[model samples]
Each structure stands twice: as structure tokens, then as C-alpha cells.
Target: MSIKVFLKRVLIITMIILIIISALYIFQDKQRFTKKTGTINFSTKTEEKNILVNKNGEWENFFVKGVNLGASKPGYFPNEYGVTKEDYLRWFNLIAEMNANTIRVYTILKPEFYEALYEFNKDRENPLYIIHGMWVNDNSIEETMNAYDDRIIKNMKRDITSLIDVVHGNAYIPQNSTHASGKYKYDISQYVLGFILGIEWEGYFVYGTDLFNEEITSYDGEYLKLEEGTPFEAFLAQVGDYAVEYESEKYEEQRIIAFANWPPTDPLIQPYEPEDYNDIAQIDVDKIKGTEKFETGMFASYHIYPNYPNFLNMEPEYTEFIDDEGKNNSYRAYLKKINNHHEIPVIVTEFGVPSSRGIAHFDSTRGFDQGNLSENEQAEIIPELYEDIVKENMAGAIVFSWQDEWFKTSWNTNDLIDTERTAYWLDEQTNEQFYGLLSFDTGEEHVKSYPDGNFSEWENSKAIINDDEAKLYMDSDESYIYFKLNIKDLDLENDSVYIPIDVTPNSGAYKSSLFGLEFDRGVDFIIEIKGKENSRVYIHDYYDYLRYRAKSLPSIQKFTEERTKDMDNFNYIYQYLMENVDIYIKETKQKLIKDEQIFESGKLIYGNGNPNSDEYNSLADFFIVGDEIEIRIPWQLLNFYDPSKQKVAGDYCVEGLNPKPIRISKIYSGINVKRGEELVYSSNLQSYSWKEWNTPSYHERLKPAYYSVQKMFEDE
Candidate 1:
């Protein structure tokens, strides 16, 4: 009952109350910083009114701003680049920051991915969502006609079921040769918005295959047969139904499911005739017998590109319309038909142009194959495509890739094998490898050197000696990549000339293939020129000229009288190779060279005229002042996207030529042409190299294009 004891008790009680209050404040602070998830849901109003809705119960008009992630640096596989936990964290954060809410994958990746997803979404509010995919191996097809082989179908069904199990954390995945085995580490089904089943099926092979006898005789009383109805379409329905049912059975949730299709199945061109209609995969979603299974959520999906299959040139069977540029633009017209045929929402899974110097296919009216586009060019056109997607009132669109894949082979460059090229090198000639918005970081910027066909401009630039008695000097500036060549007693008339440049350094030979004195492995662009009137300009290529001429040339053999073809045959091959194959060898050339009149004059007849002008220019001009030829090529021609990053000056390096700079010792005997009975001879063929110490990486020139792509999607 002392006064001192009573005061001490009151002080102790006050201290306890303060501590509780502090703890509550700390908890509230943590809650404030934590993220909230706006999960997607689907609602079925009517057969035609099904839509994607947000968790808040609002009609979700979420246009999918998504990117397809591929390990594009060291390899195309997920675990190829030695991806660590930190890398996944950084990449996911970067993707989210790029204003993309969705990241898509082609197959079930290693367990590290699932774990990364868990770490990323643990407590975050606006967590990244996944549009998971089920991969079907097409390599196992015994015959092209056996598109719906029972074994393959069974395997696909298993893949889908297993993938669903992985998503819901219900399966223990054993490490296979392709995927690292581990237990499903996290339950990511809550964030699983959709599933894409299968890939672009080449329906041409299975045009009239009757692999499935248990076919639907009719759907809604319409007569249907295996031949009348595409087998691929039937396969898609089967896969889609299985995916939806599996997801629903396991998670008890409605998830969007779409079948992956491309131009071949959809008939890149309009099926004007009944014959045309019989072969292609019928994409009309309503007509499918299993539409009921997809009643939960169905979206029309296709991989469309402007150039491939030359859809623009095909005359619309029913009708067509003009576009903004005003050239009977049937691209949107084709898309409109696809949209009209499908009652459900449409989503373009893959649609993009590659930044490459080699060209595989070319179109006069529409454009080039692989949509041959530069990184900067891709930035400009991609927005227009997205705007079109929105204008078409579609659900969403995902860019084909996130980064450049060095292991990828294109239709044009796949034939040639290069031993020196490393797996990390970005082959500018191959369009398939350059589709990604991001690229591998290739070190520091090189010194600025300009080419005006004048040696004085290259005084401060580095020079390298060559085995062929040629003095080679190289330099680059913001607007152009310059080269000066001084060869004693040079034959500008008969000898075949080649300058193969390696833009990506360390990616030295992996496959042993020679390409016109340049290492086929690491070489980005190869310039082949002869003394012909319009042939004085550098012929851009991804591989050497031999690869270009392989299609036209005779088989390689020793000098034998019996094997040697007549001069007429050789003449024809020579002319064709020089005019068509050499200049337009790689798939990337679609971005630089045009199909028509590409060799017109110093003023690039078909494309952008002047290098100095802001207009697009692909051709490089040269002034052959006697033995010294000074050539000036625009930076854009070399696939350098941004001009503002160029410098005015750079210090000179006196390093001797690097070893084996050229793929071939010389341009195949250095005798490209023989006309008028004047047999020209190439006495000396040379290969030279200079120090790559200060060379700017392809990643640097292409950064603007990559960043702009991210910014664009973000702004949208």
C-alpha cells in the first residue's frame, strides 16, 4: 500500500500499451507496401457473349500486352543460359516494369521457373500471370499424312494432363533429357489465366489424312467427313477439349484455352475455289463438334506475319478493301475474314518481323519474308499491328519473343554450317534468331569511323594486314559503317570480291563451314561485290556467297573433263548467282534490300534513295577511284537501329589483323564471271583481320529498338 509501489505499477502498464501500439503500426506499414492480385475470370453470358472478366466482376476488356519468353542468349532452351534464381527475379521484374502483365511459355520449364513464380507472387498484389502452353512433339510423325497419329495424340494428351498437374502442384516431374526433374514446387494455378495447346501445324502434309476413323459424321446436322474437314482441325478440338476438362476437373475454375494455328492452317491466302477450301484447316470455331467443351472460355489464336506466304498478294475470293498506305492491302482483309469466321474473341499468339540482313523470301507488293525488318523498323511497325489488334476488337496479342536466340536457324541460313561461330553470336543474316525484342549484351562501343570512299576519313581508324596483299582499314560512325581497302594490282573487273564482317565477337565457330573468306560462325554480314556495272556495291549476306549459290551452282568436285559442265551451263549459273543469289542470300536482307530493281544505281531505285536523307536507305554507295575503293554504307543498312548514339571521333588501334577474319580464303577461286571468251584469273586470294577491341556490339545498336518496344507496350 506504499505510494512508490503504485507509481511503479502505472509506469509498467503504460510501457506495455506503447509496445502494442508500435507493433500494430508496423503491421499496417507492411500491409501498405504489399501488392494486390487482380486475377482474371471468365463469364459465359451466351454462346457469343463469353468474355474475360477481372476478379472485381467488371467486364474485363484487358488487351493482353504480353511477351513470349525464350532463353535467346546462350541457347533457346530455358536452362541454357545458366539462369539462376536472381536472373528469373530480375527478368520477371523487368517484364512487369515493361507494362506487360502476362508472360507466355511454349513448354513446361524446369522447377526453378515454378519456384521463381512463387517467389515473385508470394505476397505481391499485382502479380504476373501465366498463359501456360502444352507442347506437342511434331518430330515423331512417321509420315506427313499422319498428322493425327494415335501415338502422337496420346503423347499430347499426356503432356496436357501433366502440364495441368504441374500448374496445380499435383505432379512430381522426373527430370527428363529436355526438362530438369523436380517436384511441382508451387501452386501457380490461381494465376494461370489460359492455356495454349499445340503449335503451328503444317496442314499441307496432312491435307487428306484419314488417321481417325471415329470421326464425327456431322456437327449440328451438317455433313462432315475426314477429307472434307481438316484432320488438324479435328486434332485441335480434341486437344482443346482435354485441356479445358483437365483444368476444370482439377482447379474447378474457368480458364481460357486456345489452339495454336498459323497461316498454313488458316490458308494464308483466301480459299477462292472449293479445291482451296478442302485442303486448309477449317478455323470456324462455331462449326467444331467440341465447341461445347470450350464453352467455359475459347479464344481464336493464330501466328500471322505480313510477308510470309505473301497473303497480301492473294486476291480475296469474296471481297477486299484498301488500307492506310493504299496498296490493295489485303492483310487486314484476311484478318477480318478470320475474325468473322470465329464467333469467339481472337488473339494473335505470334506476330512479328525480324531484324536481319539475310533474306529467305521476297514479295514485291507486300514486303519480304520473316517480315524482314530492322530493330528500329520493328518498333515502328509493331505498334501499328497492335493498334490494328485493338481496332479489330480482339482480346489480346503476344509478341513472338523476348530475346535473340543464337541457336536458331532460318530457312535461308540453315543449310550452311559454320565451325567458328559460337552459340552466343547473333547472326544478322538469319531472321528467325532476331525476332526477340531484347538481345545479348556485347560489351563497349567501338570508335566512330565514316566511309566516304576516302582513305583520309579512315586515317584515325584501325588498319589490318591481309594474306592476300590487301591493306584493310575499318571504322564506323553513327550514320554509316565505313571500310577502306588498298590492294596492289587489284583486278576490279574479273576477280570476285568479298568483305565478310563479324559484328558479334566471341561467338566463334561451332560448325565448320567457310563463307567467302569470313568465319561463317560469327559473321553477321558479308559483302560480296564484283566488277560488273551495278555489281560494284557490296552484296549483303548472312553466310558466304557459296551458300547463296548452292541452289544454282553445280556440285563441288575436282577438275575432271567428264564432271566439267559446258560453258553455257556454267554461264547460266554464274549469271543467276550474281544477279539473284549472292545479293539476296539471307532472310535478313528483306530489311535492307528490295526484291525489284535492288541493283539499280547509286540511288537505290526501289527503297529509300539517299543515305544522308532521313528516309530509309538500304543500298551502300561507293566511288572506285582507281586501285583504292572508298565505300560508304548507311548504318541502317548494317541493322544499327539508332543514329543518335553514334560518336564523331575515336582513337586508332594498330593491332595486326585478327586470325581467320574471313570465312573462305577468297570468293571461290575469285573468278565470279567469265564472258566474251576472256577467261579471267585470280592469282592471289586473301583473308584479313583487325582488332575487335573497340567494336560496338549488335546489342548496343539494337538497344533503342528493344527499349522502344518495351516503352511502346507500356504506354499502350
Candidate 2:
């Protein structure tokens, strides 16, 4: 062969090689880590002390089995219904009566609430730790909140100071907070317990901001439309002073629990990358577990949500790399991911299907009902999620909120307050039963509950045994999921279950005619599970077809290629990574008040930055409400499974060779900011001006042919 021909051949081969290796890294889901999945065990110092977190087995023992009274169906104490001492005690006593061991208080105003709660439960024999207030909203702080914020800081100091001052005896206070005030990270540095925030919340950023990358989506890139620059980036600038506090102090076992969003709608998140902690915190990368472990009362937060593929308006291929089910899975990978990250007991911080009301409808055809999963659906889906949380040796789960507006007010509400709010309120009100652990009426008292002993412990909750020979499925019909107890005569009364199913309701406005579980369209489920302790064929799920499906897809490759032969010829792996991983999603936040992008129907669109009114009819870059993005990127390029030599305990070892997950943002992406970016670009792009931009002609409007992206732009 000619020399020139040979050179060309080699170049072509190299590119092909690079593509394949990338593909393999992205497409395949395998781990090279020698580390075993470790779980954090808990126990309190003593159950007698009013203080529960002594960092001994006292936390582990008592918390091993308990229910978050406010989990499934939380009590709504509107601002109108003030938090009186009587109200606080009634809430506590109510939870105590349910036989539940734990009580998680949602976003609270001040430490006084905790003080009152502590005082109210002081006499009770059973002790509970206040999982502190939730979601410190930074978007719009109300007067009540402003007052509460001041109180929180003062009360927190007071609460701790009080503990130090006059407690019956000296004891360590278990302090923790699940705060999402990104900008207030510095503000919270004053508190003892470090904060817990899944980085994805702010437009699903995996890491804070890249000072170097100037792209619209990278770091403080122009694409950001929220509060201008990132709070983390701004916060990091000050980390220099805290360097002594942050650096010298090792990453210890903290009460901070973080979880990743599953089947994340944004395609740019992966499990192996620490930055990809869209929903869950990247504890593995963060080195949260220290050699010096917690003695007790430790808990890791886990976010649980069933697969909802339809919500993602993209091709399955778009998400092929990140998760198999294409953003619609509740799978073993998630279980395996966190298991390797922590030694503390896992607690599901948030787990609930969307109700039909206020939930943003994605697919127009699919209504709000998915958000409004029926009680039967709720019973079928949530309990299994809860069971799985417990089976992983988790402490417990805290459902989204005690109470929230499934459907809430809007600007248009002023047109017809009674009709709209009433309808919206009624719709959401009906869904309370779905997560209803028990009936709680302002006027009536709850009858049967799980306060102390009414409910069984984690051991008692185990309905399925995890072993070598266990393979089961959970199936469901419209309303009911029946697990036929594959293993017959297996006792479930004291058994905990790991049911892997999700439930969603159709969107619409409809009341059950009354508040309760007995209503039409309310999901009803039963496990027809089968198993045998003798011969030992176990039915993991009780229902026959009413069960959960695998949310993530298993990696598939007909044949494996050798990469060691030549590092340059790694195209197979690279392509695989690009196809599978979500590292490609670069988050761009356009401040609603800052930038703008829009094009009327007749306007054209283009990236060349020359927008005009003559030709373009429609606009591309506007953030309306409920906007989501589907991204694609190379996984290996971001670095995964690096086996650099290292010394661990004085032994030279090959480390960094494990599943390096990718990222997705946990926070909500903006619409107004997005709209602004679009308008800004639209007002300038040539498509809108010259009428010949990438030139979005009628042909480009077609679905698959729309763009390089396999996307169907449908506003839900």
C-alpha cells in the first residue's frame, strides 16, 4: 500500500477507535471497585436521655424501625392556624399514638417550635430527634419567614446554648439541617451541623460553577438566568477563610444526607460522577464516610421516585447512557450507588408520586393524574418504596411534606378565586388519601396508627429475603397491583417489603365526593406473592402483575474489545460513553429579569446571532413555565475509573478505579429566565431578521427531523 494511503487509514482508525471506547464507557454500567457495599449502622447512647443523638448505638437501635408521622400524609398547619402549644402537643401525641418512633418537622419558622415540641414530648418515655426545618426558601421570603429566619438563627444558637446550659446532664446534641438556601451556605456556617444540599437543585448543576468554562451552560456562563451567578461559586470565593475549618478538618461522618434524582429528566447526569449529584449528594466523591465512624443516631437521606418515562420528552436513546429505562427507572443501580457511599443508616428524605393538581403536566396527552395517583396506586407504589428504603438497612423515609398544595394559586386565580382555588384545592385535597397513613381531621382524631408499637420494626417489615436465588417482579392493573406471594404461607405481618413499583394518576379535576380511600379511580393493590421458607422459593412481591418494573436498563454489548492493546484506539468505549452518559447536559440559567429570547411564529431562528422580524415566525429560546432539557455528552471524557496508585493505610494501592457516576441538577430549571434568554437571542438572531436562520423551515418543524437532537417539542 502507498504511504499516503496508510497514513489516511491510520487517522480514520484512530478516530473510530476513540469513538468506540467512549461508547463502551458510557453505554456499559459496570464497576471496577474492589470495595464492598458498606452500610452505616446506628444506635443511641441511651434511650432514657431527652437528647437522642449521643452518637452511639442508641440512635441505631431505636431508629432501626420507626415511621415519620408526617411522611405519607403530613398535617398542614397553615399560617392561619398558628402553632400554639396545644397544636404542637396534639401533633406529637397523635404521632405517638400511631406507634411511630420518629417525627420529622417540615420547614419551621424558629427554634421555638422545636423547643415547644421538645417540651411537649419531655414527659413521654419515648424520645425523638427533630429532623429540623426543611426548604429555607430564598426565592421569595415572606414576613413570617423573615421573622422565622431570625428566629431560626437565634433559636438554633439558643437551642444549642440551652442544651449546654440546663439539661439534666451533659450530652451531645444531634444537630442536622436539610437546607436549600444555596446563597446562604455562608449564612449557615454559623450552625453546628453542616447543611445537606443535592447540587442539582439549581438547574441540576453537578458541581458549583467552572470559573474557566465561558459557555452559556458552564458555571457562571451567560446561559444562567436565575440569580445571576451561582451561590456556590460565590460561596467558594469565601472558602479561603474557611480553608482552615474546611481543609484541616477531615470529611467526617456528618448527619447531612443527600440523594440523587432518579430517571432525571435532564440527560446530563450519571451515577459515577460526584458532580452528578442532581438529587442525591455525591457522598462517595465527597468522602463523607470517615475511617472514624459514627457510633449511632446517624442517618443518610435517600430520595425515592418511581419511573416516569413519559415525563421526559426525549428519545430513549438520549438517556440510553445514563439509565436504561430512559429517565423512568427506580432500579438497583441507585441502591448500589448509595450503598457504597455511606456507613450511616439511609433515610428517604423525599418520596411521593406527583398529584394531579399543581404538578406541572409534561405530556399534554398524559394528564395531571400521574401526579394524582389513586390511594390504591399510592398504597401500591409508596409502601414498596418505603420497604426498599428500609431493606437497604435505612433508618426510614420522610415523605415530601406533611401537607402541600397539589394545585395552587396562579395570576389568573384573581379572575375566579372561589372556582379556581376551590377546584384546585379540591383536586389536591382528594390526593391526601393516597399517602394517607391514617385519617387526620382537624375536628376528628386518628383511630389506628403506628406511634410506638402499632407498627412492626424493620425486621418485621421484611416480606422478601435478599439472597442468591431471588428473582421476582411487581405488576399492576389500572388500580390494583397483586403480588401472589410466590412463596406461600410466608408471614408478612411482621415482614418488611422491597416492592419496586411506581404509580401516577391521570391529570384532571375530580373529587371523590368525600375524603377517604374508598372512591372510584382510587388505586387498590394486593400482593399475590409466593415463596417457601422450606424449599425456599420466595415471592418478593405479593401481587402477581401489580409490581414495579426495572427502571434502569442493563448494559448491553455483543462483544468486548481490548483497550489495553492501544489506548488511542478506544473509539468503541468513547462512543458508548457519549451515547449513554449524561455528562453532556450543560445547565444554563437565564435570569427571568435579566436576559430574554423569543421569536414570533413567522420569525426564523439561528445561532449566528442576527435576529430580525422579516422572516422568522417562531422563537426558540424562551423559558415558559415547566421547561426541561434533554442533553447528551461523553462519559469517559469526564474521567471515570482512574486507577492511580495511592497509599491507603501505608499500603500502595490502585485506587479511583470504581464506578464514577455522572450528574444531573436536583433544583428546578427556570422558565422565565429561559424565556428571557430565548427572547434576547431571538431579538438578535438572523433567523428572526433575515428569515433564513439554521434556517428553521417548515421541514425543520418535523419531529425527528427537527434538529440533531431526537426531541419532540411539546409544551405540557
Report the Cα lDDT for candidate 2: 0.27
Which structure among the candidates has the greatest TM-score? Answer: 1
- Model 2 alpha-carbon miss at residue 488, Å: 53
- For residues 308-399, write the lDDT of model 2, one tens digit per residue: 33222222332232433233323333544455454445555565543322122122221222332322334345444444555455545555
Give a tens-digit lDDT track for model 1, residues 410-463: 543443323123243444445576677765533344323322333464666545
TM-score per model over all chains: 0.64, 0.36
Give the deviation of candidate 2 from the true structure as CA RMSD: 32.1
lDDT for model 1, on a 0 to 1 scale?
0.51
lDDT, each prediction: 0.51, 0.27
Top candidate, metric lDDT: 1
517: Cα error in model 1, Å: 18
Q: Give candidate 2's error at residue 142 in angstroms.
A: 15
